[model samples]
Target: MLTCAFLLIVQQAGNASANTRNGRFIVTITNNDQPAHASLPGPDTLAPPREATFAEGRLAAAQTGAHSYVSPADSAVRQQIEELGSANTRKRVAEQDPPQSIVDTCRNDPRADGGKGHVFHRLWWCQEHGFTARATDTNGNLLGEASVNYVAIAWGSYTSRDILVELQKTTLGKPTGVFSDPDAVRFIIGANCADTGTGNGCAVHYPTVNKTLTEWGNDQEWHNWLITSDESKSTSPDLVLRHRWNLSASVEVPGGTGGPFPSPTPYHLIRCDSATYFAGRPKACINDEVLPYITYEINSAPAISVHDVAVHIREAQDTPDLTFPPSPTPKRIPGKYIYENPKDNGLRRIPEADEGPNRAVVRQACDQLRPIPSDEQCDEYPFASTMEGAASPDWDFSAKAVNGRENTRAGGYLRWYVFWDRMLYRDMDSYYVNIID
Candidate 1:
């Protein structure tokens, strides 16, 4: 039974290699809401735009005479408003308009909404997350309000390891609440890197010129903000937003250092906060709202290799359990095989036959299922080319007996994969393997 299974497994493995579609990557977006509305004042404030009640409140407030006011001729606008109750003159305060929508549909592709365009469908890999603050008086009447939408957009290049990134902020529209001075309420945006290896760095490059919220909001251009990474050291570039939200009106970068490990790929974690205050009374500001964590990989590498390469181990044909000892462990779970070299300072190069620590483990596992026929080889689930191979300290793996010729062909396919997909060194890259029929 075992000999017949090995023959079938090797033949199917060969067929799989011939029709392989190697390099494909999937991105995941997570909404972090741990830091939102921590400091905003009042109980009857407008909900954040990302919430359902926010739109309802906007329509309700608009009907309640929450109209935009123009600064009157008098310099003491506050005093004039105080003298003429809010119901009378309608306090004159300046609120900024929402950031203009991007013109480049190529970058900011319109997502198909319930068959209609929705506000949340602006960025391809980004979800709008931010703060909504409303300043109210002792009587709880709405004074001033502002909504800040922080969007971190990143796209990895298919040809290189570099990533293209930009920061997007929008009020969504004019504020329903009014404020005193236009500049009294301020917001600054910035970024910081986290978990990058020592000596490795990530930085955001953009113009130094200061612009008003209107100017910043109106400029929806691409490649305007660039995020560059240092290749000297390898790490999983994570972005963490600290409490100091006093950055300039432009979007920003993040950094801390560490060795590389298993992760999706290069990505950004965007967050927003408005705990800042200007010289104003009846003030309110949101503490923070960590936006969606955007992660993606450019799997395509041109003629040298197939893009987004993934390994597929067919269960019925691969016969994972048909070893000499007849073990029943399932070994082809998708994405379990991570190509890495943790024993070698986080490098990603596959180790040679005698170089890796896994050789001992592979020998031991194969020895346990000994008395093998000369025509078959000890086949491992992670292929001895990944971090979780037979020699892994975790000892969380399986090995099977497969035909020598078929296993050799599969090895050839993996060798070609490394060249075709431009698999980078370190956990900076990753690929998934699926167990199919």
Candidate 2:
């Protein structure tokens, strides 16, 4: 349609790839309905208005000869083929290239809707993961609030690793890509960008969303966490490396309740390497072991706050039947046995740091609770649930069935946030445990 630099909206909707739609990609193409230059009026300017008559020829050719079906923009914007006398047209077409949409399709043919008449698609075995993500924007509201619809296909994938890959790729694009702006280096893809294909977060992420951000609502429940990153920013520091959230899609109809969000599910930082695994051991061969923060949420409720506890408080208190002492025991616990490291061995106690923060926290715990089995009530807080390689370490973990959660305002739990990485004593992550009150 010709106009005075007219404005028109073209939405690339539909799946047109011969490749599987779910084949690691949601390819979108702008336009797909166009006739081949060969099918056009041969070298005739005075042919039909446009190639609108391409269907019949397309169908006929598909049934017989080999038809070259380029991109929608490319199909119409190509240099006229060396037909009877279309050299001039071909030159003009070549000089003008194709439309911006055509150019975009060449680079990234956006995935289409469930129909046809769109750009061709392919599975890009990208070394990178996080890219431009999209989502639905229709928050069904009546008169007071207006709504816009953002149609995006939701995809399930990694958050940090993918974003990291994209960052690395972006780095390659820059003069060095190793700029000093840490956030820029990390959240380059930006936040909330992961609306479409999500696992924890979008394009870019930050750990502050977990650490620094003010914990909202009450305690003893899951908390709705939100973080954003722009391709213009970095997500490394702000993002809990490997952490991810399971997302569900919801559409606010023109007349529906919007904010009583369902409970937030548990999300653990996905090992950047966890993507690849051996059947024998689920945990990949991680030399520098670092586990992501697990969502300490009960049910699907949003948690009120996040706390760090000793690794002992992560899961329910289970005993490792390895007979220690005169019976039989190992000095160190295996992380794997503690449900931590597969090669994890035995874990004892920090032996009290004598002073400083370690001693302080212990002392504080002892004072807070009056009775704890005895004086070492908080002392012998079952440093380790000790459930490695045995039917069960005949110990009652009933009272100790503490999942590191504390009943406060919304929901709170004790988790460990190790300063660095440790493969052996996987106890570094969260040392915060909730007392069964």
Using TM-score as the measure, which candidate wins?
Answer: 1
Model 2 lDDT tens row, 122-165: 10111111111111112311111111111111111222123121
Give the lDDT of residue 111 in candidate 1. Answer: 35
**Global lDDT of each candidate:** 0.31, 0.22
Q: What's model 1's overall lDDT?
A: 0.31
Candidate 1: residue 15 lDDT (0-100): 19
Best by lDDT: 1
How high a TM-score does candidate 2 get?
0.19
Q: Give the alpha carbon lDDT tens digit for every residue of 1-437 in model 1.
A: 00000000001111112221321111111112222222321122211213122223223222332211211122353243232221110111111211233323322543311111112210112223343334333343444444344443333222222333344553433543332233333334443233223233445555433333455456553223433444333322221111111111221101101101111111222221111111121111111111111111123223222112212233312444543334355433222221221112211335454336666666777888778789777776554676655555543445666656556655665553343223322242333342211
Clashes of each: 19, 97
